[model samples]
Target: MSEENKQIAQELIDAVGGLENISSVAHCATRLRIMVKDKEKIDQNRAEDIDKVKGAYYNAGQYQVIFGTGTVNRIYEQFIALGAPESTKSEQKEETKKQGNKFQQIIRTFGDIFVPIIPVLVATGLFMGLRGLVTQEEILALFGTSPDALSDNFMLYTQVLTDTAFAFLPALVAWSAFRVFGGSPVIGIVLGLMLVNPELPNAYAVGEGEADPLMFLGFIPVVGYQGSVLPAFIAGFLGAKLEKWLRQRVAESLDLILTPFLTLLIMITGALLVIGPIFSAVEAAIMAGTTFVLQLPFGLSGLLVGGLHQVIVITGVHHIFNLFEIQLLADDGMNPFNALITAGIAAQGGAALAVALKTRSKKLKALAFPSSISAFLGITEPAIFGVNLRYIKPFAMALIGGAAGGFFAALFNLEASGMAITVIPGSLLYVYDFVPLMLYVITNVIALGTAFVLTWMFGFSDKMLEEVKTE
Candidate 1:
């Protein structure tokens, strides 16, 4: 790590209640996720004031310090080198499970298990969008070929790039879930593979009536878990707990061989006989509910999702939406949720920019401007925690802006071909259609302009700027 990272690491440790107070430390895509023994001892304001620290927030029993993407990993290494105990995703999940009520714990567990796997999904989403772009009628015509005339090899390559992740989504979900539940990730993967084995008919095929589900134990019907979320996650959790229980009871000499064998034997049976069918039904119901909600009349769905999406982000439960968006893409080939989320994110940036423009203090402007840019680029912690949310009125104005934007998005029926990535980069996801692309641009503009105008009029005051300057 660089000297700057080392210094930032030390300041972060001190800011989060020092090394003694920190029980475990980890990093996600853009935050230093720390589990501390004494949350009250830490000064959140002081922590946010650190030069490299963009913002800080406590969610699901973890204090996450936003340091952006690349910088966070460096600071994480430095923090570990400085004697902060390194924590895995599983340890973090365990800590979270100890802190909350049953409902909160379930939500937190979902976030912990899914967050580490988002990058892979994001990459696959981008590829899906890119594949759509390259295979577009115009793009193909430019290459002297139509969709029907495209070569089988080219189509095969595109399928490999775009379909593999969703096709084996259960495996990815299971791997992450098992890791979060403190089990061997490879075993988790193998269990996931078993759920989607080629020997069994594909899940989608069974749903489409192209194949039949095999009968298990003469009663329960078993099918492949490909592209399924809840089933894989539940299986991984149960498998990990079972594996741990076996490890404790089994003899040490034969532990390695017998433990895995027994774990797999029991888990496979449980998954097929019980977990798979039940949770798959639950997942289907949830997806159906989500679809129904998103399809509500007069753009009410977008208004609700857009206005409150960032609030979910504040609690760090926003990661659950990744499953929703991915499922939407797999089933419908378009993600309208991403369109709504983009509006919310763009509103944050707009409010931040409004704050930057209204403030006379250079220090305040310095924080607001870059934070606004980061929000526009699909990251909003800096804008939300560092600027808008700090000023309650600005945050409220942003919510209204988001609601407006989302309303228009639903009215326009805006959609994206991808799950993650929004605002400027998200444009790539809609390149196959001109109208959706145009609506996406207009939706963001509505979010930005509405928030900017609203915040400028009602969200700020000279007194507030002066107080911010003094701080």
Candidate 2:
């Protein structure tokens, strides 16, 4: 392979004493990480010299080569073609569970389970925002009609758009959790449906006292788990474990019929009767904890969370927010986390823009400009590791700007119609209401402008340009 990407991969293999030295390999958003048979066999200096390789380091028993966003995936494709072990970031994450502490493993599992489901939530948020705008009294006045003038079918369509995801959310969560935890996804889906079955009293209506709950075994109150997150996730996990256990002992002659039959019967019974009650309490505690943080006095919640959100990104565990945001929405009917996080994300783009504008180095200019564009579009990995973090002061300046924006968001009591996105795309969540839309615009302006002015003024200087120029 004479192509540039292939050459990079070939050289990387050579630097690590050829492909034979590689035990396994994987990559994350920005780096290609490899475990080798002998650290002594690797030529670290030579590896760093390769094109598109921004830097190199050894950490946590893996030799990490920083290739920066899109470049890493291309180089990894070449690496795999050259006879290295085939792997993915998800598999890399799975390996981490074996090596990390319990809390870390749990976070990884949460990421694995929820990452696939976030897009649906984001789309639901967008539809909710659109439906809100279309249904508004002021908006309908332009059309010479009112919400009361709308037909029942039109209203039902709006409910389908905004409410279906949350309505069947438990099934989605259980299916994903079951897949992640190694069980039949179909079974998880069925169990989840049972949680929200029409045969049972609706959870929301029961909470509102419009319907009485079904009493199980004389004392336990039972209702549908509509919109619940943790209960479904835990049920899926325990069910997957039981299925695996059953598979090991069930005879080959009757494995198919007995294992699935027995597994479903026991899991559904246990979930409704015993397991569901336990996680319902756990879910409430989690909701309370996030609520406490969101309501911290005087915008302290926004300041702390926004300022530190990117810091958490650096550790690669930020997907943990998915669990919290969904729970917050289920409980509060609005998502303040969406408003709180966008400010920080906007600051990241701002910092990168400042660096791109101020830097004389062509290489730094090349990296910072596109990275800034991506950060604005709600993907900050490139902007972060490629530009701002490379210049320490820009990142710190951005944090201050984020804190400033977050303070205003909380103080204004701003809430979004959605989550799972931020910055430019995140603007969708605020469009339903004029006042909150203005507040959202102001939040980004403050964040972007603050970081821009700070970084252009003092965060960057001509001195740092020399290293970037040479590299």
Candidate 3:
């Protein structure tokens, strides 16, 4: 660690009660989340005032001190060096599960399940966007070929690159959910695969009436769960619980065979007969509602979604939006959701930069600058948690900025070909058209500039810096 980081780490340890009060220490993307034995022992204000500490808050029995990305890991290492008990993410999760209320535990479970699976979707979304770009008429015209005239092998390659993840999405969801719920991921994956078996008609094909659903017991219809999420999650949860129950009852010698066998058989039957149909209907309803909201007149949908999207992120349920975006891409080949989401993300960056420019403390500036840059490059957690949300007015200004940008995006009917990756990288999703591309740029500029100007005008002051320095 750098000398500066080491100094900041020692200061942080002192501010948080010199390590004695901390039961366990862990770090996430941008914060040192410490479970303290006694919250009263820590100097919360002093922690927030520390050089590298951007903000501090207590939530769900953990004291989270914002340190911003690379800095957090170093601080965490420093804690370990100081003999603090290190905690893994799973352990922290279990701690929260034990301490939090039912709703909080459910949200935490969702975060645990989805956080690990997001990278796969993000990578796939990027490939999907690039595939759209390469196949666009303008790009293809450069190669002197129309869509029909493109080489079959080239199209085959693109299909392989882009379609595989969506085709097997259920398995991915099931595996992650199983891991989160404390079940064997391999068994979960097998159960997920069975839901999407080749023997059954594909979900999309069934929807399009191109194939028939399989009849079970003369009347119950069963279809493959291709591109589905909810059924897999439900199946994984029930399967995990069932597996545990079976393990407790069955003899240890027979557990290896009977546990998985019964878990698969019972879960698969339940999925096909109950979970799939019910949750599929529920998912359809949600998609319809989201589509209707986004389609509202005069850009109202965009304004509302863009302004409050980050609030959803704060609640840790934003991963649910992934399902909506993926469904939009599957059904319509366009995702307006990405444009609005980008507006919100860009606004956060703008607000953070404003705070960076306004703050007199070199430490605050250092923390805010890279986080702003990260936000523009399609990651906003550092910006939001480390800077903007730390100050209430900046967050509010960012929301207004996002609203303005989103209104424009909706007015232009701007859409992206992919679900993930925003701001500069999001441009790839709009490469098919020059108008949409320019609109994307304009949206980001409006978001960033508005937030920057608003924050500069009202978000920060000399008084706040004086207080920090004194602390």
- Give me the candidate number with maximum TM-score: 3
Candidates sorted by TM-score, descending order? 3, 2, 1
**lDDT per residue (tens digit) for residues 285-313 in model 3:** 98899999999899998799889999888
**Which 10-residue window in model 3 sums to the lowest lDDT?**
462-471
Residue 303 displacement in candidate 1 (angstroms): 0.2
The model with the greater TM-score, 1 or 3, is 3
- Show pairs that collide, candidate 3: none
Instruction: Provide the overall lDDT of each model, using Cα atoms, as 2-decimal numbers.
Output: 0.86, 0.84, 0.84
Lowest-scoring 10 consecutive residues by lDDT in candidate 1?
462-471
lDDT of the structure predicted as candidate 3? 0.84
> Across residues 329-352, which tens digit of lDDT does each residue of candidate 1 receive?
767667889989999999999999
Candidate 2: residue 152 Cα off by (Å): 0.8
Where in model 3 is the C-alpha error above 4 Å?
1-6, 330-333, 467-471
Sorted by lDDT (best first), the order is 1, 2, 3
Output the TM-score of candidate 1.
0.87
